[model samples]
Target: MSPHFPSMAEPGGRTLGDEEVAAAERVIRSGMLSAVWGTEARALEREMAELYGRRHAIACSSGTAALHLAVVAAAPDPGDEIITTPITDFGTVAPILAQNAVPVFADVDPETGNLDPAAVARLIGPRTRAIMAVHLFGAPAPVDELRALADEHGLVLLEDCAQAWLTELPPLPPRPATPLAAVPRPAAPLAAAPPGDAGVRLAGTAGAVGCFSLQQWKHVTCGDGGLVITDDDALARTMRLFSDKGWDRAAGRSHASFGLNYRMTELQAAVARAQLAKLPGVVEARRRTAVRLLEELGGLDGVRLPRPEGHAWWLFPLVLPGGGAREMAAALAGEGIPARAGYLEQPLNRAPVWSGPVYGTSRFPLDGADAGRGPTAACPEAERLVADTLLVIDWNENYTDAHVTAVADAIRKYRPRP
Candidate 1:
């Protein structure tokens, strides 16, 4: 049991305070809570779109909804295959299934825990239609190569940047003839392999479309909101309709294709705008603490930090040897710091629900009523990733240097505990 720390009682109320309250009050006073008109949601969308350098941005109810809209926007045919990494939240894969598309599990780079382009190449087949690269734990994957691969095969490249917000990473590396084969990458999620920089690039800006989460745990929170960014005007228009149940507000109740009601409310939008304003400072605080920790622990024999430029430091992940991450987590917990031994309970491929029938005996994608589940041996490298290392720390923008030092000292005090 951890004792209460002085930092725990800073009176930060969910990143909301007088500022957000004032914004909400203004929205309420306007009497237009819907996003259809020139309201808070619309303004938030405009600001977000411009912020990311995207021509259009669509606000939705959740990050999962944003992904679903992206799938629909791509217009994937039934039974089409989308290659993605398994080391992610269920939201990442659920969209493919919702669109009646098959999710082809691809191996990930052990160091960054990102989709390995070569592994994705191996999985590409006749049914392949798209590839999704998740910036796992806020580190940039090999986006240029993935984009090139998608272009070569006429595939749509979608980026899932849930943990990555404002992550300016390395420039595109030289295109490899083939992506290197995946090996046993220990704590690839925590210890990213540094990609030499040619210049700087943002995480979600690399692909044809990028999805981001603003859930409570993310870099910024609108309580629970999501944003989608894209340069294609027509595609953006289609996404707007998809998010609003196929109704074109500009056309006055005109209907287009079938869609869903995934609109972000004015209240959420109001708070989102406020949060966005504070994001630069939020990011800088985490960056400073993360950098200090790196300097303190980087040379500790078994410790390593992520590539400086590419990592957003969403989680201050550390790769530890042996199987003592659980002990480390417990010890940190005792000191009032949070830690986790592994990223997920299990890789998505091995999840029980994924192996079962969907929509009551319909498994067109995974098992097709025959196997009723996808292949278990898929994404072997992903399996090794979680089993091998520990995420020694979790990050928040409010954490100060003292908090970071406490984390480092705790880890140093205990390691490879038998």
Candidate 2:
């Protein structure tokens, strides 16, 4: 028999239930598979909007498409530099290129893996137009600070909450830090509770725009879909129109500008709507398991896990700054635990498209002369974090305390001796 552990909780497997299956079946029976103008797509939008306490949530084909729509709506200028973290999926930066913009990398917090606002502040230049703060691995970046900085610098603050569905930054005067599982939560209607009550707000609600992924591996999945949440009505309309080929539904179906077909199907929307009601449970499960792991593993030599409070625990990322991520991962694998070193092998700036010629040697975005100057070294901390020390294990809504213990045991098994 193979020594590798069985995959525990993939997004689709853990979250997909009777409601999701029934939702899809109902959509199939409805005879209206596509909701180009109405039905489930619209319902999902309203549901997600209300859930996050946002005024608008626009549905789209993919997370990348949602981000692209955000870029198209808030930043349309070519060569505009968007300051973002290097420790993120390409979906975060791909949209910048789609908008003919330059993506500038800012270093990340070694602890949380979220964008370091100070690094972002330093990276801001004359051409810089926006700061895209990714809630990396479900831990929120200092978004309120990023927002204030954006206002101070006249730059847009965009929150990429693709992996951070229910993650929130606690209200000011955060209570004495407690494990996420022990934090007293108001019973029932968690989504309906206003941010003022808990002095806490969801990660995506603070920025000029927020993008979420409902991809297969994300916290929630509609097979493959995306949602754009924003408080600005004009911005929401722009995003909606942009995703719908610039055809403003309110404007008698007239095309307003150049756009793309990034519409989500009604089938996907039906599943997403059903999935929304269960998101609180999804987040709770991951948070509880994550908190337990932190409690057990905290203070372990050569291992660093971010604070459990306010983190969504999308993936249980750990940093071994002493540097044995890959070897540790392999050891964990041998012990019937799953893990991998580095979320992404390198920063976004080092991606081939960044330094490579744009078209026939005309590299307008990276550099007019040499595309090699794409700023890969802009975030050395992120490079080292990924290349030399980061390792992550799957975290999901189905993980239990036992699973947490197993993971912790595997990590300690491979813990490097001082």
Candidate 3:
């Protein structure tokens, strides 16, 4: 009875169907391959923006580029520090560096793996310009608290919505009665708030801007592309110029500032347009599959499955109880599943790249100016998660119940070799 056979299965490989192929082919035939005001890209942006309750959406080359543009559009001054979670894709951090802004790493909550606002508040300083909250693994961060914190401190709030496109978070609850025995509950929805108004709002609409990824592996695949959604018309226009090499499309001339060519190809846009149409279905499938997996993995000792929420479930992350994420990953790999432990490195702050002159550590005034500051001091919770996390293979609209069961059973049977 080799559990390996059952455990090693994956969701079926994804492919573009007839409609997608037609869209791509149409773009190929049109010869308007580069960025242009076309129906396809426009429609895609409109649809996605509407989907996320955003006023505008600007499609870009990749998620990283979208983040960079969003940071730039938010207009944080050079050398300003942006507080962000360490538990995220480097793309989320790279954009901060690209703007010459320092990324002050704030730790995330161990359970949700999202930026902890309390941790962020502790780390905020004079130069804190913005808070880039990444909704890790499709769970929306506590955006409302982050928003209030941003308002209190006069900081910009930007969302890395690449993981969470259409997810809505429950509101934070109100404080309990201290002296009194109990307080009467508020009306229906209001009563559900978390204690101390700690709940987060949805990423895009709540924050100043939200960014999304349509990378091939994401629930919606546009081959490789990203988008920035903002309610600020002026910022949206500026970002358009930034994406188009500082060219003011209206004037048909180059602007003063040097901007990068972060435009998305029409081909990608066309494909994205079609994909956006299917996002709801794709997201639903991933959610259904994840629900099944969570149920199957329930109550398994030494395995911490992610809690279900109104999340998109990008990656199925499991935290091994006995501190054997690496060994568990290896055991799963030996069984032929595409499982892997968390990042090989510690906090990005500790990475060699950050220590060098390239990251401007010598030039900037971080709290620990001389000592290389790591999340160990600032973000103990995130550090713990980084050490204990493991990932299972996931994709858009590809998973089945059988696949979910297999992954759960694999986790149940995994035993680290001594």
Best by lDDT: 2
Q: In model 1, which runs have C-alpha deviations exceeding 4 angstroms? A: 1-14, 172-200, 369-375
lDDT per residue (tens digit) for residues 1-93 in model 3: 223322212224454678889999998888778767566777778877766656789989999999998889767777677888877778998
> For residues 191-292, what per-residue lDDT tens digits would candidate 1 score against the true structure?
333232324467777787899898977888877899999989988988889888899877887898788899998988998999888777777777887888
Candidate scoring better on TM-score of 2 and 3: 2
- TM-scores for all candidates? 0.88, 0.90, 0.84
Q: How close is candidate 1 to the true structure, as a TM-score?
A: 0.88
By TM-score rank, best first, the candidates go 2, 1, 3
The CA-based lDDT of model 3 is what? 0.73
Better of 2 and 3 by lDDT: 2
Q: Please write out the lDDT profile of model 2 over residues 155-244, one tens digit for every residue.
A: 888889999988888676646878899878788756545533355688998888899999988878887899999989999888887887
Off by over 4 Å in 2: 1-12, 173-197, 359-361, 369-374
User: Number of clashing residue pairs in every model?
Assistant: 0, 1, 7
Better lDDT candidate (1, 3): 1
Give RMSD to native, each candidate.
Answer: 8.4, 6.2, 6.4
